[model samples]
Target: MEPVAENKRGLMPGGVAKRRFKLSAGDIIFSILNYIFFTLFTLICVFPFYYLFINTISDNELVRTGQIKWYPVGIHFNNYISLVNVNSLGTSVLVSVGRTILGTSFMVAASAFVGYLVTKKEMWGRRFIYRLFIVTMYFNAGLIPWYMNMSMLGLTNNFWGYVIPGIVAPFNIILVKTYIESIPSELEESAFIDGAGYLTIFTRIIWPLSKPILATIAIFGAVGHWNSFTDSMILMSGKPELYTLQYRLYIYLTSTSNLSALMNSGGSVNTSVLNSVLNARTVKLTVAMVTILPILLVYPFMQRYFIKGIMIGAVKG
Candidate 1:
């Protein structure tokens, strides 16, 4: 401890400190690029929501008077209140919810079972059958044929009309099959060695292992069913009584939006152009939120599965 390296010239008694100025050209370029992309994507994603939110709460005069509102403009929630306005929106929500649950369950369960069978090595030339299903996915039999088929079977305007025909999706089978392919064929063989029947192996092993793919399929199928407008429009056309949420909302917007025709096509009442939104644009947005929000909530949960599913397969079982 004689000198103890404790001289005053020893910057810290043991060592000297150093500072650095490090900024590579690549770093600076990436910094600028990151900021630019962040801003661009922010605007791109935000604008439509901004438009919807602002219009939803905006006063008609402000919107119609040429004052663009990038934010809330006086909070007129009456549109949402009225659209949801008690039992109407609630009932529509129920219809959509019911359809989504039943339809997705029907599709996932049925497609998964069929997918399991189709994926089996001993299924003996399942490729031709699978191809037939996939072909139907690309080339539909057209509206008239579909309508005629439904009519012949009396499914048109029936509740089954919504849940049955499209419940077993071909592409969903492919996705589940791909995931199933990742599973070990040895697992099934082992189960067979233990006297487990096909159903037992399917229910106990394949079903459990297939959850991720099933969840991914569930989200897609549920969203499809929830957002289904075309099917409802065609099948329930004359029977508005059976119209689903999207279909009913479309009908409401169409019937209500044209105020000019309703109030006499060419009359000059100088109140502002934004009043047009009142006709049914407001209703349309409200209904859209109603139909979409539940699925948006669903999205966060299944999103990981769907993302991973595109890349990975389960270990072959």
Candidate 2:
């Protein structure tokens, strides 16, 4: 027998050879094209944020003149300092942080609990309850009606406004419900046989086993809350103190009169430092980064679980 080619075989026990699969020419070309496409796509997707970051660090004049591209020119760090010095900075940060934590926690717990309840066949009105959620996915009260309802509930200008209405998310409930259904029924049966109550079984079995989906949903909740400015804009309109960081940034960018007044403030602000920070080109770029930076830092930690959970939850078992 002719000896097998080294490229076509892998050595096994006692020098026995197993056939090694080789990529076809088409496969290699397809892979190369795939890599090139994704590489270009990534650059396209990333360049805007990169542009914002580099412009943020460049001199305001250089940025405005559109001369600073590919690299930062006349580097300056005072934009960040100016952002920190905003009168509402402390309050905005506090509100954003508080709402993000509280909102994420409440939404995750509510979604998980509702998801678990729906997965139980013995639950009362299971079909009706699930259909109710499905109905929400397709239909929504218009903005005016929603605003009126919230007003009726006295959620306007309330701190709970940030955390309450978002607690019951139909999409999150569906993702979590699908994930929970994929779990083995035997586990719950075993728990029930050991005299475990519904809450106990959920806390002990479901919660721990559901980490991937939970982490995915938690990241969603956190990002949604962190980036949420519309809710603050409408619900907390009367309360400047409750404004989130993103909304504060919005006010800073849009209110030219306010920006001018801030730039001219003589008290506490050093003339040179204030001048550096008040530049339109720099402040907006820096504030944009400041608003999104936390979410950017957080996503990497959750990315692995996010991918896994989303893939698994997409298919109903």
Candidate 3:
């Protein structure tokens, strides 16, 4: 008998040809359907922002008439340009930037440190303290009492109000604590053997290792600070200089007279033409675009860490 012909495909242990895997018709159909579904989903999610954007750039006259859907018509940048003329716009932008940076930094550092501390077996009442932190996440004093607390603390109209009250974010601490627990205790033990103090080990070792979760916390804190106008509305009502970008934008969007005044403030632009070119519709859309741009720009940079941190941090908690 002729020797068995060697299989052209890879052989199994018994010298039988291995079956090649292939997608069935159902899989191909499912894949096509999946692609279609996600594509439609993506467009649905993205269309509002695109619509907002086109309206801001389109002819204000056409925008007001709702004729600028799907694509921009008679595109002009007058809406954005007119914002520069709004009083305190520049100051509000600075205040917003300042609060976001400082608030995020303080929140991240406080969360990291508190998270690390709670992981220590030596700390007395560590579990109690951590549980207390978690409790705040579920409970809140009414707005009236909260406002009273802020006023009593003299945080109202104070820049520190934005930073200080949010420093110890309970949810962030929980995430950080859970993430830190997943780290090898051997590392901390080794540091302890090397005459390293808790602070040194934390600052030198834990901090670096905790970047993923810290970044997640930072994004959360920054977005909270950037988007929060209610705090500004309540606390900084007396302090226009401390007004945030969101608060200023909120005021402009709600007040037609403010929009008109903003257009008129641009002396170089003829009032008659400017009024038609930069109306309430265009200004509202433009402010919405401006308010959203910073978070959009920043989110992509931290998304990888955010995903990884959330997944790992959430594993235990």
Best by TM-score: 3
What is the C-alpha lDDT profile of model 1 across 1-317, one tens digit per residue?
57545445545454764344799999999999999999999899868766766776777556545465577677777777776453355665666778889999999999889989998777978989889988987897888998999989988877788898877798888888888888888999999999999899999999998888898888888988888878878777766656778877777666555654656766555456535445466667656666667876788888887777655643332
Candidate 1 runs further than 4 Å off: 1-25, 64-68, 84-88, 256-279, 313-317
Model 2, span 171-262: residue lDDT tens = 99999999999999999999999999999999999999888999999999998899889989999989999999889877767764554576
Q: Alpha carbon lDDT of residue 148, candidate 2?
A: 98
Question: How high is the lDDT of residue 314 in model 2?
Answer: 93
Error of 2 at 46 (Å): 1.9
Q: All candidates' TM-scores? A: 0.80, 0.85, 0.86
* lDDT to native, each model: 0.77, 0.87, 0.88
Q: Which candidate comes out best when scored by lDDT?
A: 3
Q: Total clashing residue pairs per candidate?
A: 9, 0, 0
> Which is the winner by lDDT between candidate 1 and candidate 3?
3
Deviation of model 2 at 200, angstroms = 1.5
List the candidate 3 regions with Cα displacement exceeding 4 Å. 1-20, 257-278
- Tell me how far the alpha carbon of residue 279 in candidate 2 is from the true structure, in angstroms, after superposition: 2.1
Check candidate 3 and list the clashing pairs. Answer: none
lDDT score for candidate 1 against the true structure: 0.77
Tens-digit lDDT track of model 3 for 1-317: 96555555677557777677899999999999999999999999999999999989888778877888789889889889988876787898899899999999989999999999999999999999988988888898989999999999999989998889999999999999999999999998999999999999999999999989999999999999999999999999889999998887778666656555765787364576646444645776787899899999999999999999999998997
